[model samples]
Target: MASLNVGNLGEYLREQRRSAQLSLRQLADAAGVSNPYLSQIERGLRKPSAEVLQQVAKALRISAETLYVRAGILDEKERDELETRAVILADPSINERQKQVLLQIYESFRKENDFETLSHADADVDADVDGSGSDARPKQSPPSS
Candidate 1:
């Protein structure tokens, strides 16, 4: 039999619920779903509808859009928009380099209102080393000697 690579929406939901320190029963109660049904969904035996996914996401304190993406239900443009928004929202403390990059991105979007024109090369300016380790920033060279 051919193998199937089903969506991981259920797994993602389960993981998020666990991370939030909620039990299956608690999550089901909060989500207004049946415990057994939630369990089956977590075990990959049942696929949840978009409405259920949104409910679960609300109960888990996660974005419904993210759940939709995990469920493979979001369109390409929506997925990209969600991913970009996630990047901006994931980090609360923006370092100087990150702030600069964000500013540049904002300016570029303001000028053209196009994200496709933004390139990794355009953002590579210097090396950013923080507690999280090194990430390549836009390359900046020393002033001429």
Candidate 2:
């Protein structure tokens, strides 16, 4: 399995910034950082703190949680999500907007699958509660044999 790579965070950030049509200096100003500092961050030469990532995320009009995951500040089940997005963003096969579209579709599919799974699970639980599931309920004897 591929290990997590925070280096891709820089590229992802840069992609987000550009999609917003913000130049390096513009993003730096918006995020309250020096231009050189932001440049270093985008170049993957520097790792930004949580606060910095938050500020940058806010400036880009995106969720800070995404930045937190990318920065390795929020390591948990969220890592898979962020890493999947990072890989999508890094893929050269698709362009930026296409990547965004694909990500949205992927998320929707996951949600739909989860919903279906839960619905099935809930049906099973309901059946159990009602003792109506096959092999669960008591069988009756034949009458007038």
Candidate 3:
């Protein structure tokens, strides 16, 4: 019953195709999809599956994971993590060992944040169950007569 967010994916695909100097028909041929179907996808009249997106990404010489993220198949957090790892791995200044260490540290920090978020949520739930609202404001006494 809900509309899927495919418009952004379509726009992104069009942009990538254009940037690669390829026409809709050419891209469709390269991606092994029909021209009309690719056009429909670009117009947001169709939602392509992950395999289709992967084929398109290959035709465009782009990352399939990026397309997956734009197509809403992957979470934004996953994209962020992948991008961070890519940056770290691509940095020529860092040695391979250093890059591995940095990635390990980054992963640990992410896990720590996830744990803290869960702990805070649990605390809020406990506060609600105990008949004290989740708000942390201190209770105030009425003014004396």
Q: For model 3, where is the 10-residue window of minimal lDDT?
A: 130-139
Deviation from native of the Cα of residue 129 in model 3, angstroms = 2.0
State each model's CA lDDT, in order.
Answer: 0.74, 0.86, 0.90
Q: What TM-score goes with each of the models? A: 0.53, 0.50, 0.78
Q: Name the candidate that leads on TM-score.
A: 3
RMSD, each candidate, Å? 12.9, 11.8, 3.6
Q: What's the TM for model 3?
A: 0.78
Total clashing residue pairs per candidate? 8, 0, 0
Model 2 local distance difference test score: 0.86
lDDT string for model 1 (14-73, tens) is 889989999999999999999998987887777788999889988998888877777777
lDDT of 1 at 72: 73
Rank by TM-score, descending? 3, 1, 2
What is candidate 2's lDDT per residue for 62-134, written digit by digit as tens? 8787788778788656766777888899999999999999999989988998899999999999988888876
| Candidate that would win on lDDT | 3
Model 2: clashing residue pairs? none
Error of 3 at 30 (Å): 2.8
Local accuracy of candidate 3 as per-residue lDDT tens digits, 52-137: 99899999999988888888799889988998999999999989999999999999999999999999999889888776765656
Q: Show model 1 residue runs off by greater than 4 Å.
A: 1-7, 82-145
